[model samples]
Target: MSLIQLYDTTLRDGTQAEDISFLVADKIRVAEKLDELGIHYIEGGWPGSNPKDISFFREIKKVRLTQAKVAAFGSTRRAKTTPDKDNNIRTLIQAEPDTVTIFGKTWDFHVREALRISLEENLELINDSLAYLKNHVGEVVYDAEHFFDGYKANPDYALQTLKAAEAAGVDCIVLCDTNGGTLPHEIPAIMEKVRATVATPLGIHAHNDSECAVANSLMAVACGAVHVQGTINGFGERCGNANLCSIIPALKLKFGHECISDEQLKTLRILSRTIYEMANLIPNKHQPYVGNSAFAHKGGVHVSAIQRHPETYEHIRPELVGNVTRVLVSDLSGRSNILAKAEQFNINLDSKDPLTQEILENIKDLENRGFQFEGAEASFELLMRRALGTLRHYFSVIGFRVIDSKRHEEEKPSSEATVQVKVGGRIEHTAAEGNGPVNALDHALRKALESFYPQLRDVRLFDYKVRVLPAGKGTASMTRVLIESGDKTSRWGTVGVSDNIIDASYQALVDALLYKLVKDQEQAG
Candidate 1:
């Protein structure tokens, strides 16, 4: 297989995305993961931009990466200044990374408008920056920012910028679609011009403004670019960058390239999820390869065809990327879909069983009433278990009361809840105070059960979402609550619906605790 290098800039460019910020430790963790996945280069960050990035460079050195080289990113030296005297260049050198990536304005428009510098000065900046960094770092990768746009506007000047970096002894010149406006068909011809102009190896760094970053990157590779730059989950500024999760698999499976080992490729889905968790961002279910819904089959005709022949609906084997074919349970699901889901959950049932029909009816009825089981698999599992007569009742709620009050103007509002529950033969009553009524209820319920099931302490509520059911009623509408509860080992979701918001939240919370207790019991067995 041909070799294609994978360069990840999730730590630097990915953080430029809104609502995506990682601590120094998060960067190190992500870097380690990337190295384990056999990435060729891991861009640490712009050490000159922030103290956190500087600290990241220092800390990442402690990690002995086997396959990946850590790279520090920065920009070209300021106009009319010596590269060594420029603070950005000096700081990048001080970071002591094995590789240094510096971007310079290749577009004449940016140089004339943004930098307000002459064209010759911009070329000088690129040359000086790469030459100075090459003396300190083992490899110097020059990013020709806005290369595509620059080439379209001024082809001779764009090629000159690449020639300048090549003359400066840089290792590679990466053409960046900074504006993400370049089309896929345009990459090959442009790359042909770049190859003709410069002898250095070429890389592609694409943005997703046109929703074609992946396609553009692939086209660049087809046109002879060896290295591809992207983020783990396509996290970046504005729309995002090319998603390495999708690109890596395509490179390895489709193009017969050696980007990552088969074993490493299996961890792609988990890697994408880990980054989303660290960023505290919801994973997009519809993401191309690594998303939860990527391999999910829902329609009756599709599910039936998929069961007979796995490739009938799926483009690629889901297992090729470490993802499973999910048979989602919904109103549109057929008997075969139910049977498939039951098998996955380890709930034995015959395809022709009457219980299957009953469960399907129940699911349709519940869904029509606003219970979406597609995103609430945990709730669906519980429903299936109950229908199969295998669900165990861990506890029964006796009663609960919640109160909110603000005694003083200077103090924040406080909430208190009293919960009573019956476990086995004994009754436990407890009261707790919290920042909100739901929190208080959570605390009180956990307190009531911790004495009976010590494992309850490990189960914590991480996320809680409530949606008002559209019943054409505004204030009196029914509310649906979904609570995500987890221990250190695993997490699960439980949902509840009621006209009263607090009542709905309490029901979901109770189910969450009960689910934890059941799992603990099963494990103990």
Candidate 2:
């Protein structure tokens, strides 16, 4: 099997995806990850496009990558302009990278329609640009812009353009599915014909418009391509580009091809999660290789079989990608599911015990009442403690009251809240004013308890969201609230549902504090 090179254009093409912008610091962080992941090439960004990318290219030069070469991206030199004087060309050259990827127009229509250059002149442009870069840079990659669609429309012209790059001694001729509308079966035949003619190393650059970028890239490899290029998390123009997360493992395990180190295969999950967190974007749970829920089991049959032998249900071992398998508990959960979940919850459960049935019944009732403990492990932990009588109360809620009033236009809207609590044998009274009655109430409660727990300084109200249950309809029924908070390392989340929104919020708030308190206690002791 041939060794394939993995090129990541996440910082450049990935950022071009709708509404994605990364800072210079994060771009550097992402580059570090790509290097750590053992990618062969990291296309940092276009230097002239934005200040952030320009700064990133400059700073990244100072950093060292163990296995990857940094590549700068830009278009070919402008028409009737010298490559040295053209700002786009100059930016790529000054970025001073190991490999420079310049995209040249391959589609005759794009040349005629977009560039308004004659077909023969367009071929000259491709030749002159590649030749110029070959002299100045260590390696030159020619992305034949819109190569796939152009091949379908005007095969002779597209081949002529790629031939131009090959004649110019470019390192690789990258075929771009710029429109992302190409199908899988269309790959091999097209690639086979082109590979027979072009002696240049072939690379595949696909988009996700049809959601087949990974599959198509794989197909191209089978047809004789050596390099695969894409952004992380399938991010790019339109729908996005092929996701390197899928492409990497697909090449390694599926095809017996190798691109990254065996160690990178271990840390893949951590790298994927880090990128998503820094981007502040939710990862696709079903994303093939590194998704969190990739190996999760919910059905009774799958759970039973996986319990017998993980390979019965798992395609790859969870630890192979630095992730662990998850067993979800829900309405479909049987005794095995419950037992497995209990084990994960650290709650002892004898499978044959009557308590198992009781816990299941309680879970069903809670689910019906709009309580989602699947994501709220803190709430579920409290349930297990209450059921087992193992939970110890950390604080006391003695008495609380709130007063809301609105003065004239000159005065600000305000509400006052007070809490009276007895901690250990001493009584503490605290009061505070806030923007809303609930806010005032929360402040007062925390103030009253802070003396007993000085660690509350690190704990905080990070985020709060409320959802009215479907049972409410138009009447006064119940509301569900999810509260998330964190300290330094890990974040803990909890939920509460009640007819009163304030009560729901309070319940969730209480769970957050109690969980943190318990964690602190565990660490201290």
Which stretches in model 2 have alpha-carbon errors above 4 Å?
Answer: 402-416, 433-441, 460-463, 475-477
Count of clashing residue pairs in every prediction: 0, 0
Encode model 1's per-residue lDDT on 1-525: one tens digit a residue: 679989999999999999999999899999999998899999999999999999998898899998999999999999878988999999998999989999999899999999999999988888888988888889999999999999999999999999999999999899999999999989878888888888999999999999999999999999998999999999999999999999999999889998899999999999999999999998888988889899999988889899999999998998878899999888999999898888887789898899999999999998887777776677888888889889987788899999999999999999999999998999998999987999999999999999988989998888899999989899999899998889999988888888998998997888788888777777889
Model 2 over residues 75-118: C-alpha lDDT tens digits? 88889987777898888888898899999998888999999989
Please name the candidate that would achieve the greatest lDDT relative to the true structure.
1
The C-alpha RMSD of each candidate to the native structure, in angstroms, is 2.0, 2.2
Worst 10 residues of 1 by lDDT: 369-378
